[model samples]
Target: MGRGLGALIPDFDEDKAQVSELQYLAIEKIVPNPSQPRVIFDEEKMKELADSIKCNGINQPILVRKIDNAKYEIVAGERRWRACLMLKMEIIPAIVRELTDEESLQIALIENIQREDIGPIEEARAYQQLIKRFSYTQDELAQKIGKSRPAITNAIRLLDLPDEIIEHVISGTISAGHARTLLSLSVNEDRINALHKIINDKLSVRQAEDLVRRSMEIGKVPTPAKQAYVFEKESYIKENIWKKFTFKGNQKTGKFVFSYSSPEEKQELLNSLGIQ
Candidate 1:
């Protein structure tokens, strides 16, 4: 199923361990999944989570599988595990399950994508790893991850951007939208200048897009243009925001609505943006 870890994990109450598999395993015995998709965890968010766990304790048990008589590997709940470690928690509630390497990777990937604000570059690298390790076709992987094929294509496309641009995407200095807009320019110098403008000037996606478009029309980076209009509230226009949504129109103008066929898919997008 495309439902991520939720598909593999059984539903249970947060107040208590309702599943019989729940056990309080020593934290020292657990090791991180080698194929874990997330590299960077938000420091502020991690502290926030630690505070929550400190006050309330873990609401859900982590998932792990025995690697040897004395060792275990995390199947999911790495963030929870990490948080408990921060608290110097000696043992964590966990559910032991026997899963293959591919299953472990798949669960971790979906869990992060659906539940965390994983960066586009990290996300793309995760997809790349899954494809390279498992020899999965884009379509198959799309279905497995509960994302559209075009969505996968768009995410992976960000990997081809300059490493500097990729670093910006990972660091949240600039957005994947800005990087993708830079992809429109074939010249490295122009792309780098546009990236600097994005960081220094703090440009929006539409502004960046317009900037790139102008640079493409001219040979070099042109002068910044005046605003067409300013709005009172944020989210000035829906059409111009640089999300990885599918666009329908072409060359000059296009329209796309944030449509989702399932609640899970919709919620995943919202979680990625840190929206409630």
Candidate 2:
């Protein structure tokens, strides 16, 4: 029986039918908001949910809006909609909402932010989208996202990293602490190398930050040779290398020095080599 909008909804009817107040159907729907701000989605997690739906069925409905003929756009529960598709369901439950272009984007951003599910990278990208696409100021973005302006600024600055560095951060190759250290550098290349060092050495955030601050305090960051010699060498090794090596004094002034074997040791080496 077809009932009016306010009529009582049946618990179960017609062999088997699923309905959800939260999801809607739209046909020929183009994404009203073509661009989304968030970046990360845990595909594995979503697939797990899809598997659950396959076994138990979709208990919750997704929200979609009809844009035109045979097209529907997702508004909320996008993951659920995706899961439903994965399950190869012909007819899926959804709640339809008539949302304007601006309203749809706003809803999507607000929902993701409120849920705090967006990754740091995604959050930064979203904030950037709001500014670039919507022409919103940093202050305005902060207000909308309920964050401080500085927080927003730091998040956005993260995008300035080289793609490799960003990948490192995304893959857990580098800690967020180390990423922040790289972010503090003026040059992206330096940041990238610093990131590599941090990962290779497994330096703590504090250690990385200190290194950065030290570099800034000095007129020029020490060259790799100097850095290795001065900061990395032990006193005993430095003395031994200095005493044994015959090299240029100015060149030897830096952190490293090479050790030379004594004459007696060299003779012993020659005897061992059968060159006496």
Best by lDDT: 1
lDDT of 1 by residue, 80-181 (tens): 888887788899998877766766676676677666577788788888877887787999878766689998889998988876677567657787888889
Runs with alpha carbons beyond 4 Å of true place in candidate 1: 1-20, 222-276
Q: Please report the TM-score between candidate 1 and the true structure.
A: 0.71
Any idea what lDDT model 2 has?
Answer: 0.58
How far out, in Å, is residue 208 in model 2?
A: 2.0
Superposed by TM-score, candidate 2 places the C-alpha of residue 225 at a distance from the truth, in angstroms, of 10
Compose the digit string of candidate 2's lDDT tens values, residues 153-184: 88888888887676566556666667778777
Flag clash pairs in model 1: none
Estimate candidate 1's RMSD in Å. Answer: 14.2
Question: What lDDT score is found at residue 11 in candidate 2?
Answer: 24
TM-score of each: 0.71, 0.62
State each model's CA lDDT, in order: 0.71, 0.58
